[model samples]
Target: MKKTCLNINATHGGFSLIEIMISAFILALGLLGLAGMQSTAVKSTIEIQQRSLANSLITDITERMQLNRLWLSGAGNSYSIDSLTDANLSIPNCIGSGGVFVNCSGEDIKNNDLYEWKQKFTGAEVNASTNGENGLVEADACIAVSPASGSDGELVQIVISWFSTVKSKDAAANAGATDLTNTCGTANAHRRQLSVETYISKSS
Candidate 1:
């Protein structure tokens, strides 16, 4: 019997350079997408926090005003502060004979409340640091009152404005949305604002 010789060829079984490069490209793209999403989420979260804080501050002042019915009853008439500034509010430390918390009078309490509220904006309170929980930026407030026809009630409008680090996309469209021209004190690209309206009865 005669033996026949056969030749066989062997090939390497690993990924080619092109395949590795493609995989690397795909991974890079995925990472980039994730980074973009994270950035957008952070921005959105910041905006939501700011809005919530503003709402809380507004509610706080409103509740205080409601509690002081005498002050809001047009007797003291301290509820109608317009374009209130930090300089406009001043309150002495409320302390008793033995360093206790002294109860202020009706109008005095109103002044104290206004001072405290403005301090939240200016970050002057002990709990408030610069750009702290009180506010992310310089803030201002306004209070307006309108007399109602007959004996219904008085319309009160409260507005809070703040400078925003994030630029507004629709600022032009919302140019006339608020009357807070000097909110940030300068014509900046980023400006945020909130407003609340309520009616206070004359009887209150």
Candidate 2:
């Protein structure tokens, strides 16, 4: 047998510089995407929380009004103020048997309820000069009522407005104005709103 010479060439394989750079770029892009998603999720969560709080506040006032239906049908009907503020809702401390917890009469209760409701916006004690609470900022509420038409019952409309973290040119342009529909018409894009309506029968 004749011996034949065998030549074997072995080449090592590894990533090139360009390949490494490409991988790094891809990783950076993925990280950026993840960061963006996280930011969006946080914003969405905050918005949901704000909406839930607004709903709760609305429900609270609605229940209070229902409880005092008698008063709501009478002098308390004035509760349907177009724009509500702390001054208009002010009331003296509870008097008589119930003390601070329970108001003395229906009117007293209504007053107390209004005062408390205003506090939710101002986030301070009745006598506090400034808002110290971390609740909604610059929150406002509007109440409108239409008298019963035939047998359709009385219509009550509630609108709540609050300032958001976002800014809008339209909102900023109309700042300091008294237009409730354009509450965010100032420069704040973060303005949010919630509105609800209910009917109260004359019998109820």
Which candidate wins on TM-score?
A: 1
Q: Write the per-residue lDDT of candidate 2 for residues 71-181, one digit (tens) a residue.
A: 666633645666565357656566544455543676788777777787765556533655345466667777777776676356777777777655543333443464445
In candidate 1, position 65 carries an lDDT of: 79
Alpha-carbon shift of residue 9 in model 1 (angstroms): 3.5
lDDT of 2: 0.68
Task: Compose the digit string of candidate 1's lDDT tens values, residues 46-163.
Answer: 8887778778878888887778766566543757665666457777467445635576677777777787777665556645444345554666677877776786467777877766
Candidate 2 Cα deviation (angstroms), residue 72: 2.3
What lDDT does model 1 reach?
0.69
**Clash count for each candidate, listed in order shown:** 0, 11
Cα lDDT for residue 4, candidate 1: 96
The TM-score of predicted model 1 comes to 0.77
Q: After superposition, how far is residue 105 of candidate 2 from its true place, in Å?
A: 3.5
Q: Estimate each model's TM-score.
A: 0.77, 0.72
With candidate 2 superimposed using the best TM-score fit, by how many Å does residue 106's alpha carbon deviate from the native? 2.9
